[model samples]
Target: MDHPSPPRKAPTLCSLRTGLALLLHFCNVALLSQRVCLSLTMVAMVNRSEPRGAPNASLAAPLDNVKNPVYNWSPQTQGIILSAIMYGMPLIHIPMGYLAGICPVKKVVGSALLLSSLLSLCTPLAAEAGESLVIACRFFQGLSQGTVQVAQHMVWIKWAPPLERNRLTSVSLSGTLLGPSVALLVTGFVSQSLGWPMVFYIFGAGGCALSLLWFVLFYDDPEEHPCISLHEKDLLRSSLAEQVSSGGKSVPVTAMLTSLPVWAISLSGFAFSWTNTIAFLYMPTFISSKLHIEMRENGLLSALPHLLSWVLSILAGHAADFFLARKILRLVTIRKLFTTLGLLPPALLAVSVLHPSVSPLSSVVGLTLASATAGFCMAGLMINPLDIAPRYYGFLKGVTVLIAMVGGLISSTLTGIMLNQDPDSWFKIFLLMAAINVTSILFYLIFAKADVQDWAKEWQGTRL
Candidate 1:
């Protein structure tokens, strides 16, 4: 009698690779968070109650004194300094995939962070020199980190299996939220007591340290890791047999950029990022100027929304994996639904937050809920790159991140022009953000899908 073999057991998630990936992501996010704080901290130190009817407060700089030397860059100069990072960010994404393809992903990601950390260490010295140096250093910081996303995707391509993809990607990316939260909470105290320069020095030190740790522990291929057990490695190889190829040619650039799936993911990511950069760049200022909160207190208050956002993102990732694993819904349906759940409610709630009649406490609550719910997109658009093209995930990530960086540039610069120090005018900015979020979700619903595209494997026999 012929008997069917028993079904293979699903692999466990308690692998060393998962932990290493998570930690690398967490540390990189922390580096990003610290750079974000420099601008907000400067705003606090330089503005110094000027909006409380002080003369030319927006353009004033403190005279040389005991605290770290000051630069009185104008509002226009400050705007340029903040946007400098995004200017360099968008230019590097397209090239990053090629770098990741040629080099070990850990080398690419770790080296980039090391450079960013070194740049962060030099920021105070550059700032004291003049505005131009500050802008130049900030731009290069963004340049160094631009490759991080693409490199991480390259690592995930060789590491994650289908059943574990959602949880793995979301957990790794949760640093997007945690980075800013930690930055806001800690930077305030570090700068307040130790001086503003320590903010960069303390944060940059971790990035430099982690790059060396990453080199020691991480390997680009499952077969290459010194620490992985034989059984787990075999499972990984077997799981990846069809999805990835060891002798693959470069990703087809025209095929990638022209693909509908890529554009859908990229466009939606633009909207998601537009809303997010608002929180990163402006939330502290809003909390401080509007609610009568001080800078350190404002950092704490600003951090609350991000902390809740982080928790919700993790829960959302787990729930997404659960739904997909049980086959309770189609993967495509689940992704679109998650997008709606994340972007729609946040947009609807954000409008109410801007109402003049709302009290500061009520406004804070409203913003928190909106931000927390926005975390669901982490499980949706963010992970779709690996879903559609495991072999070329790095390239796809570059495309999407580059698209989103354009939105970051626009939102950051526009907010600077729109808010000259007045809290009352901020409601209009919130509404504009809500409208963009709503529109982006609508477009995503029409085009987004979760299945691996046929073109994903089309490069197998083609010329390089």
Candidate 2:
């Protein structure tokens, strides 16, 4: 009998794991750019003929030259449109989370992102048709975009080794901040130079292209990847042996719903979402209204906080892994410590912007610090679901994020109402956010854990 040859392994010159990280980062970048493009573009899209006391001497001439149609949307209307994206997000998370367990997660996420991108392409037309149509487009975009949030976590189940989880996940998630940062920095200029519609077109097209690339390049599991080397596959298999099951199983619904650690993660996510929603969605309006910055410059300034956040997000991940590798701190302690670092100082810093004689520089510094510090949470409660329920991380993430989305939706709509009622209500909003941050961190400290829960291990008898 002829001896059987060993199975062929792909070349190991390029690491598929790192490739996955890069693709995930860009996926977030594409998805988030599409999501936040409206925030900056809205500044240029609105008819601001009447000055609200901000100096516009330099911008008046240039703005007059641009002939884009400007809508007369009130603060309330703008808030509704901004929050519309979140409306459909909650509806899809649980369903998508379940689907990720049974389906090829890459396909589900790629298809959803592609649909969302297509909707973004139609946004300008929707706006031209009516504000309702724009809101509808945003709502549907949220429905599609929401699937990515949950399903993407499933990819990590088979790919991220336990020891490197923080580094991989954080690096991938930093794209969330970087995506919006790039959008805020460029959307105003793009809107001004090529009309507001072009901003949507460029980002939407980019998202669609990325979606196509994901379909081609990414795989649900390392074993399924043709280009993944044998050594890499073996490494992942040994590292994830206990964590991931061979196939999907029904999640323990009652156990998840009753778990304190689960609630801690969900509530912590909610608090972060509330503060982040205010910072990202309303910062442009705040800078323009309070600092008297022009649209182009407003985009630049608004981007500073997010850029810092993107940098710190990656740093926090490295730090978390460093602690874990050295056994410097227990996993639970590390999670709590990072959570405190992320939430508490930012809350204080946000409140500092309420100073009576705050200068533009001081206000910018405060807000930037607030946003950057919050990025530390990426390695804290944000990744805790994976620690406790690696097998069902997708479903757990969906549940937590569903709660978080509610926070984002309320924060946006509430901020809009407050600002509409009194444009100077930012002080009150900051105070409320500070209170929320403190309360959230306290709950996480008291109840959060890093060990795998018993119910989460029932399917595979995992012990990490």
Candidate 3:
């Protein structure tokens, strides 16, 4: 009867440890939450700066005179200044990437924001002084912006888990689409009522405020954050341990440049960039001329395609992850399938635009479909760096971006030449861009790989 008594259960070591770890983790997360909340509130206050004129004041004077004698600037001149930020970005991104490899991401990111804010502050003053000063200010702004982009990608790699990488990367990249949405919605109203100078002032001040918050709140790694609980920190560390272990110490810039995979990805990005920039930068102009849409309507309509693009990007990323998790397809197959499908639509849509009998609505729909489809390619090609070398994601992104920049330059020049030759022949330029998009698919199908390559394995072994 005594032997039949129920045995008492013992507390397992793993259970006890997990409980203690969770308790510590929560405490640390609470502290971090408070800091982030405070930082966000401060940023909100900075963003509340009022425009120069009363809210209801007429913006027509500034709007009407955007190309007037006071500035004596053509639309082309203003475009050059606005685009300078984008153009100069690729040039500095490479060096900035190397710096990110050596320096703490938080410092690199924070410093770049600080510098960008400072440069942005100079823009209003420059414009008031002369067009030359404006160009100079924009050039510096481009450099700083490029540095920020590189550093931001580095931060994401350092902080986010492998599984969550695409989602988080989308958040950052979405800014490319979202920034224009904000500008189109607000900038016209702001410039119309307040003045052109107010635009730069608001953006500059906002950047400065964000820089302050970034410095105070961001930690390069979870382990380095003062407020993170030991348990949560451990979780973060364990999740990324494999990736960290696999990534070799940083190689020389020349060696990185010579990497076959790197070159392949870069070349692919170049083709994608050419097609994408042509669609985004020139499509509205084409629409206005061909479809007889007003400037305001054109701006709004142009934004619709990118909205479709943003949605498709999320869906594609999720679908890619799903296939990857089920082991239904290799990463290479996943990339190839999506990228090829994405590229095909643009070419088809470009052909649609060439048809003289196509209705304007049909043409717009075709263009929208093309932009939306192209976004899926980003799910594969844009994310390849994170797949192959999580540690060197920033450096690789920089290299690809530099290559893409050349493509953008070529696209711009080609567009200008085509327009000069025959403004009515915009369809010809689109056809050329469509060819580039199609060629990108061929390159990816032939060369791009989803898995880590021999060089990476060799590098990892040497480092270990």
Please name the candidate that would achieve the greatest lDDT relative to the true structure: 2
Q: Candidates 2 and 3: which is better by TM-score?
A: 2
Tens-digit lDDT track of model 1 for 15-44: 865786587667657666756877567654
**Model 2, poorest ten-residue lDDT window?**
51-60
Which of the two candidates, 1 or 3, achieves a greater lDDT against the reference? 1
Least well predicted 10-residue stretch by lDDT in candidate 3: 35-44
CA deviation > 4 Å runs, candidate 1: 1-13, 49-64, 245-250, 421-423, 460-464
Q: Candidate 1, overall lDDT?
A: 0.75
Query: What digit string (tens of lDDT, one per residue) describes model 2 on residues 178-217?
Result: 9888988879888777877888899999999999999999
Candidate 2 or 1, higher lDDT: 2
Estimate, for each residue in 349-407, the C-alpha lDDT of model 3 and write its tens digit.
Answer: 87786788888888888888887676776577777877766556666778888887778
Clashes of each: 0, 0, 2
TM-score of each: 0.91, 0.92, 0.77
Model 3's TM-score against the true structure: 0.77
